[model samples]
Target chain A: MAGAIAGALAVFFVLSVYLLPQSYLGSIHPTRPGPIVTDVKLSQTQVVLGESFSLQVSATNSGEHADMQILSIAFPSLSSTDGIVDVQKHDFRQTPLFIKKDRAIGAGYTAQRLVPAQYPSIEASNRPWNSGETFSIELSIKPQTEGEFVIFVKAVGLPHNGDQAHWPSNGTIDHQDEFVSVYSVNVTKA
Target chain B: MNYQRGSLARMQESRRLVIGYTLVSAGILLAASGGTWDVTNHLLNKPETFFAPPHAVLYTGVASALAGMALVVSASRAAGQFDWSAKFLIAGVALLLSAGPVDFVWHSTFGLDGLLSPPHSVLVSGMVTSSIAAIIGLVRASKVLPAALIVVAILPVWISAAGAVHMFSLPFSNTAYFNFNPHPIAGAIVATLGFPLITAAISHTSSELTGRKFGILSATAAIFLFINTFTSIIPNEALVSTIPFYIATVIPFVVADAILARWRSPKSLYMAGAIVGITFFMLYYPLITHTYNKVMDNKTVWGSLTAIIYFELMGPLYPVLLAPAAAMGILGAMIGQGMVRRAILAGLR
Candidate 1:
C-alpha cells in the first residue's frame, strides 16, 4: 500500500512538471496547395547605407475551397540580432494576446504561441485566406551598414504544420492542392 | 502426471517463465521501435493527436511489457521465489506504462518539445529502469537464453540516455545538409546530456553481470543499440550513419570491464563511467569533425575552442559530463550491488 502511494505521487509529480501549460496552441486550419502561389518583390535590389526600402509580398490561394491560413515568417533585418538595420512589419504589441483555456483549441496546436509572435513568426494577418483570395504584406527597412544579407521566409500552409509537436512538417494533406513554401532573397549593398 | 505433488504444476510454472519472458522482451522492442518511429512520424506527419498511430504502438508495447513481467514474476513467486530484483523490474515497467497518460497530458498542455522535453524524459527513464528490471530478472533466473534476451531488451537506450537529439542517430553527411555543420548539434547533445547519463545507467544496470559476462553484455548492448539506432533512422533520412563506430566506440566497455575485474568498488565504477562517457566524445569529436570537414570542404567550421568546449566537442565532455558520469557510476554500481545482493538472498531462501 505504501509502495502504491509512493508510485502514484512520483507519477503525479512527473506529470505536473511535463504537462504543465507552457503556451497556447495555435488554431489548426485546413489549407490547400496549388495554385497557392507566393511572391516577394523588393523596391530596390541595391541600396546604399542608411537608404530605406520596401518588400511587397503577395500570396494567392487559387483553390476550389476556402483556404484557411496562408502564413509567412520574416528572418532577417531585425533590430534585436543586429544594429545595422531597422525594420517593421506586423504590430505584435497591438495584436491582442490569444488567451484560451487549455484544451479549448482543437488538436495539432503546440504549447508555444507561434503565429502571433514578436518578430520572426508573425503571420500576414489573423484573417483566413479565402478561395481565389490573396493577402499582401509590405515591410519597410533602412540599412545602417554596407553588408548584404538574405531575408528568409518560412511560409506555412494550414496543413503545413506537421502532426508531431515540433518536427519537420509533412503537409497534412487536408486539401487537394495544399502547399508549403520556404522562400528567401539576398539584397545587394551599393 | 500425479495431481498431488504435481510435476505438471512445475512444468506449467517453467512454461510460464519462458512464455512471459518472450512476450515481455518482444513488447519492449515494439515499444522502443514505436518510440523511434514516432520521432520521424512527428517530424513528417501533421501536429499529432496524443493518440497517434506510433503512440498507440508505444502504449501497446508498454502494456505487453507489464503483462509479461507479471507472468514471469508470478511463476517465480509461486516456486517460493520472488526477489527485489524482480519487484524492481515490475515497478520500472509499471512506471513506463503510467507515463502514457501523463505524456498525453503533457502534449496537450505543453505542446511539443521533440527533445526529451519533460514527461518524455520520465518515459525514457521508465524504459531505462524497466530494461534494468529485465536484466535483474534474467540474472536471478540464471538462465542463458533469458539472459541473452536481457541484452536485446536494453538495446536502443544509449541513444535515449545520450538524450541530445540524434547523438548516435542522424548521419554525419548532415553537416552539408545546409550551410551550417550539424555535427556540432550531435556532439553538443552527447557531451552535454548523453555520455554521463548513459555511463551512469551502464554502471547501475551492469551490477549482476560481472567479469567476462559484463564485458559480453556491454559489447552486445553497444552493438545491438548501434544496429537498432541505425535501422530506425537509416532508410528514412540515413540519420543512422555509421560514423561513431569507426572511432573505437567499443573501447570504453572493454576498458571499463577490465577495471571491474580487478577493482569492483564504486571508485572503479566511477572511473569506468568516466572512461565510457569521456572517451566516446574524445574520439567522436575529432572523427566527426574530420568527416564534417571532408563533406563541407571547410576546415575552420565548428573547430573553434569555443565550439570544442561548448557547441562542437571537448568542452561539455570533461568535468561537466565526466564528473557526473563518475558520480552516477558509483551510485548505479552501489544500487546494482544492493539489488544483486537482495536477489541472492531471496533465491537462497
Candidate 2:
C-alpha cells in the first residue's frame, strides 16, 4: 500500500509540474482568440550576389478583438526549419516569429545558414501594430556568399491590455504569417 | 566506537558518498550539457517545446540529481546522520524540475526573456541551491576528488549565470547581437559572487588546497566548460565558427596560483578572491578583444569597426568591472566559510 501510494504521488507531482502552468497561464492569455495572419513580401525574388533588397511585413486581425496591441516585430529563429521556406509552409511555430537570432544578415539567409548572419531585427518600433492596420518596414541586405535564402519575419506584442502579456483581447494570435512572399537570392561568384 | 565499528562506519560513509557522487555527477553532466544544447537549439530557432530532445536531456539530468540526493538522504538517515545539506539538495532539485513546465507557461502567457528570466531564475537557483547543498555533503565527507568532479560537472551553470546577467544588461553591451562578448562586466560580477564561495568550500573540504589547488580547479573547470561549449557550437558550424573560449578562461586560474601563493586565513581569502577576479579579466581582455575585433567584420551588423569601437568604449571598465569582482569574491569567501562551518555542524562530516 505504501509503495503504491508513493508511485501515485510521484506521478501526481510530475503531472502537476507540467500541467499546472498551462492551465493557470492559459487562463490568462489563452492562446489569442482565433487565427490571426501575418504577411510578408519581397521587393524582388531573384537577386545577384552582394545585392541589396527590401522585405515588407504586414498584419491583419481576423479575430473579434478590435484593439490588439503588437509589441515587437522580429526576424525568424535560428533553426533550419525556421528559414523563409519553412515559415511559409507553416513548419515553424509562430511564437518565435519574433526570433532572438542576431541581426547579422540584414535581409535573410537560407535554412542551412550557409551565410554568416540571420535577418536583421525590425527597426525600433514606430508604433504598436493595431487592428486592420497594414504597417511595413524596409530592410537592407548584403549577401557575402552565394546561395538561395529564405528570410523569416514576425511581430510580437501585448493585446488590448496594453503592456499586459496576456490581456486576452478575445482574439487569437496567428504566430505564422497568413501569407508570405518568399524570394530566392542567388549570390553569384563576384 | 570499536575498531570493527569504526571500519563498518567508514564503509557506510564511503558507500553513501560514492552513490551520492555518481548520481549528482551524472545529473549535473546531463543538465549542463543539455542546457548548452538547448540554448544552441534555441539559438538556431528551435521552438521551445516541452518535449524537445534537449529539454529531455536537461530533465533527465535533473531527475538523476534528484534521485541521487534522495539516496544520499536515505543513507544519511539510516546512519543517524540526517544531513541538512542533502535534504536541501533533494528539495531544491524538486523545485528546479518543477520550473520547467512553468517556464513554458511563462513564455506562452507573457513572452520569453531568452535569458535567465524570472521563471528561469527559479530553475537556476534550484540547481545552485541543490548543487551547493550536494557539494556541502561531499565536502563534509572530505572527498576532495569527487567534490571536484561535481564542481566540474556543473561548471556550465556558472557560465549560464554569467550569460543570464548579460541578458539583463544594457542594450549597448549586446551590440554584437551575441549573448556574450569579450568584456562581460555583469557576468564578471556574478562570477565573482559564485566562484569565490566554491573555492572557499573546496579549501575547507580539502584543507591544504587553498593555493595551487584553487588555480588547478579553475583550470580544470575552464577546460571542461570549454569542451562542452565548443561541442554545443559544433552543430552550428555552417552558421559561424567560434574562438576557443576555454583558453582565455583557464589562463587566469593558472596564473592566479602564483600570485596568491602566500595568502591564507579567512580574511586573506578575500584578497585571494580579488586576485582571482582581477586575473580573469587581465588574461581575458587581450585574448578576446583583439581576436574578435579582427574576426567580426561586415559579416556582422556591428561590423569590425563598430564592434571594436564598442570594445574601446568598454575598455575603461577593466578596473571598473574588476573592482566589483574582487568585492564579490571577498563576500563569497566570507559566506562560503560560514556555510562550510554550518555544513560541518549539520552532520555532513
Candidate 3:
C-alpha cells in the first residue's frame, strides 16, 4: 500500500509540474489581466487649513493583450494593513474633518463619495487604458482642520469585458483591493 | 530452543522499530503539509483563527509524532537498550508538545504577534528538531524500508530547515506592537547563506542514503516542488506566469543528481552541490522574494499581484548572488556527506 501510494504521488507530481501550465487552468484570464498602479506622486505631504494640494496617480494596464477600463479612483476609506484603526469612526461624508472638498477634479472625473462613509473621491469610466499606456488622475483637495491624516489612493477597473465570470465587478473600493498608494498628510492651522 | 526464542525476540524488535519510525515519518509529513498550507492561507489573506483547519492538521500531526515516540520508547525498553537516535526523537517530541502553552501565553500577553515572535520561533525550532529526528530514524531503519521510502523521508527535513531559515530572513515579523523583523542587510546575508546550504545539504543527504542513486535527489526535489508550488503558487491567479519558471527551475536539480550518480568522487559531489545551491532562489520562488525585500529596495505592498512583480524584479540581480550561494552550498554538502558517512561507519546502513 505504501509503495502504491508513493508511486501515485510521484505520478501526480509529474503531471502537475508538466501539464498544469499547458492546461486551461493556466490561462483562466490570459487575454485580459488586471490593472496596476505604476507610480503615484503626491504634490505635497503638508497642507494648510483652507489651502489646497493635489495627488496625481499614474496607472496602466499591465496585461499586454487588451485594454482595461477603470471604474473609480478614490482615497479608500479602509486601511489595507491589519490594524485597530476604526475607519468608519470618522465618517467624512457626515462631517468632513481633514478634507473639506475637492477644489478642482481631473479631466473626465466626477467628485463624489463611492461609499456612504468613504472619503471624498473621483470616478471615471469612459477612458480605456491601453497596453503600456499610462493615464494620470490628479485630485486637488482643500483641508478643513489640523492634524495628520493618512490618505490611501486606489484604482479599481475591469478589462473592457474581462472574464467577468472569473473577475467580478468590484462596485466599490474596499480593503480587498491591492492596487493602492498610501500617503501621510499633515494639516496645520492657517 | 533458546536460539529459536532469541531469534523470535529479535524479529519482534525489528518489527516494532519499523512501525515506530514509519508512524513518526507520517506524522512529520502531515505537520509539514499543514504548516505549508497555513502559510499560504495567511498570504492569501484568508480569515484565520486558532481553530482553523490547518492548525488542526498541524496539532493532529504533532500528536501522532508524540504517540510514535512513546511506542519507540516502549519497544526500546523491551529490547533493554536505547540508541542515540531514540534520544533525539524523544527530545524533539518534548519540544513540540511544550510549544502550545508557550504560544498561548505569548498570545494572551502580547495581544497579537508576527511570524518570528518568540513562540513561533519555538514552534519552528520544534519542527526542525522533530524533522531531524525523523530523518535520522529513517536512516537507521533503512534495512527494513525501501530506498524510495528513505529518499522520500528527506522532504520534511528540507522544509523544516527552510522554515528555520525563514525565521531569521523574512521581513514579515513586524506588527504594530513588536518589531521582530531582522535588519535588512542581516536578513539578506542570512537568506543568501542559508538557502543554498539547505538545498545542498538535503540533496546530498538524499543522494548518500541511496548509494549514489540517480533519481533520489530528483525525486526529493520533485516532491518538494509539488508541495510548495501547489500550496503557494497554483492558488493565486496573478502568479500563473511563474509556473513555467518553477518547472524550469527543476532542470538544475535533475542535472545535479545525474552528475552525482554518474561520478563517484568528492569533487563530483562538490560540483553537484554547487549546481543545486545556485537554485536556492528559484526553488523558493514567490515566498523567497520577501527575503530580498530590503536588499532590493522593494516598497510595494505584499499581496499576490505585487508578489509576482517583486519576484520578477529579482531576475536582474540574481546573477550577482549565484556565486556566493554556490560556495555556501558546497560547504553544506561537505558537512551533510560527513554526517551520512559517520552513520554508515557506525553500522546503521
Candidate 4:
C-alpha cells in the first residue's frame, strides 16, 4: 500500500511539472505585438541658419490589430540632447499625427504625415501602425546658430489599453527608442 | 479498558489540544510573516510602489494562525466524535484554489489600487488546502489522502522551479520572444510565495512515507537540492528579471523550512538546522561579499550574482557541498528515529 502511494505521488509530481508552462486558462486577449519604425528623412540635407527645414519620418504597422489612440509623435526642445535647428516659432501649430483617431487601418497598411513649415521644433512621436501601414512625420526646423549640427527625432507608441489619463502614462510610457538622425548641416553666412 | 471519562481526562486532553494548536499556529504565523515580509519588501522597491502596512501583516499573521488553529481543533473534535466532515475539507480546498485566478484578475486589472490583496491566491490556497487536508487526515488518523494532496500541491512548484533553471542556459538570441519584460513586484511575489508552500507540503508528507526515518531524510535532502538549484540561478545583484525565481522559489522554501524545522515538532530540527547553518555559512556568507564587490564594481553581473553563486556552489564540478548536504540529511533521519525511540522509552519508564 505504501509503495503504491509513493509511486502515485511520484507520478503526480512528474505530471505537475510538465503542466507548469501551459498558459493560464482564461487570458482575455492574445498579446499584440507593438509597432515598428522603418525609415526617416529631412526635407533638406543641410539648411541655412535661421531658415526653416522639414523632417520626414516613416513608420510601418508591424503589429496585428489596428491601434487607435496610440500617440507616436515627440516634439524637440532646444534643451534636448539632440542639438536644435532654428525655425520660425508658432505657438498654435498642431504637430503631425502618426496614428489616425478612431480609424483602424487594416493589417499591412502604411500612413504618412507632413508637419507645416510654421511649426518651430522637430516633432518626434509614434503611434500604433497596422501590420503594413507605413507612416511618416515631417518637422520644420530653424537653426538659431550653426556649426556642424545633428537633429534627433524620436517616436514612441503608447499601447491602446494603457492608462493614458494617469500622470506618467500620458507621456511616452514604454520609452521604446525608435529614433532617426539627420545629417550634419552647416549654416553659412548669407 | 473503558477509556477514563472525567474532568481530569478532559483537562489533559484539552491541554494536549492547546499545545498542538499553539505549535501549528506559531509555525503557520512565522511562515506567513516571513514570507509576506520578504515578498512585500521586494514589491515596494519595484515600479509598483504599493505598500501594505505593518499592521496588515500583524492582522494576516494573527488571522491565519487563528484560522489554522480552528481547523485543527475542529478536526480533533470531529475525530473524537467519529464524524469526519468532508464538506468542510472540500470547502477549504475550493477556497484555496479560487484565490489564484481571483487575485490575478484583481491585480492585473486594478493594479496596486487593490490594496489588502491577499498573497498570491495560488499559494495561499495551496497552503490552506494542504493544511486543512493535513488536519483532516490527523483527525481520521488516515494518512494516505493528505499525503496525496501535499504531493498535488508540490507538483507545479517543482516544475516551475526546474523550468526557471532551464531559462538561464537558453541562448540570448531568443530574448525577444522569451523575455517577459515583467514588472519587479509581480516577479518577486510569484517566487517568494510559491516555494515555501512546496517545501512545507513536502515536510508534512515526509512523515507518511513507508520508511518514515528515510523519508524524512530524503525530503530534507531534496529541499536542499532544490535550494541549491535556486541559489545557483538567482543573479547576485537584484534585477526584476531574477526576482521571479528568487521570490517564488528560493526565499520561501529555504526560509520556511528553516522556521518550520526550528519551531515545529520537526522529526529532525537539529539536523536540519545544522545542514542549513553550514550551507549558509559556507555558500551564502562568503558569496555575500563577492556579490557586493560584483555589484559595486560590475553592475552588469550584479543582478546575475545569484546565478553565479548557484553555479559556483552546486555546478557539476563541486561535489563537496552536495555530498555533505545529502549525508547530513540521512544522518538527521537516523537521529530523528533515535529521538522517537527515546521518547517512547521515557514514557514507558
**Per-candidate TM vs. native?**
0.49, 0.52, 0.68, 0.32
User: Taking the tens digit of each residue's C-alpha lDDT, what string does model 2 give over B150-174?
Assistant: 4553454344343333333312222
Interface RMSD of 1: 20.8
**Model 4 lDDT per residue over B76-154, tens place:** 5644742232344345445544654676675566553211234343445444543444343333332232333333323
Q: Count residue pairs with overlapping backbones in model 3.
A: 0
Q: Model 4 segments beyond 4 Å from truth?
A: A1-74, A78-190, B1-91, B97-105, B108-211, B219-269, B277-306, B309-349
Candidate 4 global lDDT:
0.36
Candidate order by decreasing lDDT: 3, 1, 2, 4
Taking the candidates one at a time, how many backbone clashes does each contain?
15, 13, 0, 44
Error of 3 at B319 (Å): 1.0
Native-referenced Cα lDDT, model 3:
0.66
Best model number under TM-score: 3
Q: Write the per-residue lDDT of candidate 3 for residues A26-114, one digit (tens) a residue.
A: 34443454556566666688878667676666655556433224533344432221221212222111121232133333221111212
lDDT of candidate 3 over B30-92, digit per residue (tens): 787788778766665555778798888887888878888888788878888788778888888
Q: Pick out the ten consecutive residues of candidate 4 chain B with the lowest summed lDDT.
A: B165-174
Q: What is each candidate's DockQ, to 2 decimals?
A: 0.03, 0.03, 0.05, 0.05
TM-score of chain B of 2: 0.68
After superposition, the stretches of candidate 3 with alpha carbons farther than 4 Å from their true spots are A1-190
